[model samples]
Target: MKVSKEQSDANRAALVKAASKLFREKGIDGVGVAEISKEAGLTHGALYAHFPSKSALAAEALALGLELANKKLYGKSADEAPDLDAFLDYYLSTRQRDNLGGHCAMAASASEIGRQDEDVSASFTEGYLEMVRAFENHVAQARPELDSSSRGLALVAALIGGVAMARATQKSNPALSKKVLQGMRELVDEAGGLGKK
Candidate 1:
């Protein structure tokens, strides 16, 4: 039977939602198209109808995942207080570390993305730059006397690296893992407060 336009759009959305979560939980190469379709409660044929190729699906998925992350991390407008404390409290929490699919896409898939095609890499790069710009603006508000752009990049690097390290040591040295998160949070928080009178 021919699917209606509405149903087709719904099915496409479902696939992208499922793809975003699964691809973040598992790297782009970790999960396959068959698994994504199954997770979305659709067949492989339906998945293909929506996306031309797995890479295409993955690129979209990564973008969606990062978009969600950005919304979660930074609010809707530049006027919002950068809430670095809130970000640190949640991001470094054990809950965020445990939920791989719900965390930042970069921390989840940056390594694997480097090996993928240019489309996927480009998607990641674009999301990353957007995040940096947001962070820079926020940092500037918090600390006007310093070079906010450079500091913003450092802050992002610290957050991503801290989360990655925490996740990596989560199973082994849990204490060190917690310290990694706490330490990075402290450093970033201190830096943000540095230039304030």
Candidate 2:
């Protein structure tokens, strides 16, 4: 009847991973603790042992999702700047739009974060600022003439909004979804001065 520290850590990680994927696929409000526990191959009681409440688990899960996405976009090291063109292409692609459970947390849960607890909101804000800082560094290098901070914020907003809109219209209006992605990509390209000398 007792668990090792290693096993406990592994279990907690599993719970977070499962919760992150499920929350992205179905909104946070839509998932129950039992389902998350079941998905993680743990008991409902085990979930409580790791996290005080579902909201606590949700906050950790959201942080994990955002961290993973940032790593994917920016690479393992902070010194590495992402290629804006490649980032735009992948982010606005139908592939990312359709992969609900495996994309950025911001776009997946943007509509629901406003209703979540302060901890969840703080996690979202931290993740978002981390992304903006990385983007700001990249923009500063690429276009020193531009206000990197403002451009970074604008790029992130457009990227998150574009993906969310594309996903919302994907099933009911595929054409419009594609157009939305295209328009966002064009906007980013223009803003970043991608095609210019």
TM-score versus the correct structure, for each prediction? 0.91, 0.94
* Candidate 2, pairs of clashing residues: none
> Can you tell me which runs of candidate 1 are displaced by over 4 Å?
76-79, 194-197
Off by over 4 Å in 2: 195-197
Clash counts per candidate, in order, are 0, 0
lDDT of 2 by residue, 1-197 (tens): 89999999999999999999999999899999999999999999999999999999999999999999888778767676666566667778899999999998999998899999999999998888887886787778778999999999888888898999999999999999999999988787778665224
Candidate 1 lands at a TM-score of 0.91
- Candidate 1: what lDDT? 0.84
Highest lDDT against the true fold, candidate: 2
Model 2 residue 121 distance off true place after TM-score fit, in angstroms: 0.8
Per-residue lDDT for 72-126 in model 1, tens only? Answer: 7677775675555666687778889889988898889877887898999999988
Error of 1 at 7 (Å): 0.8
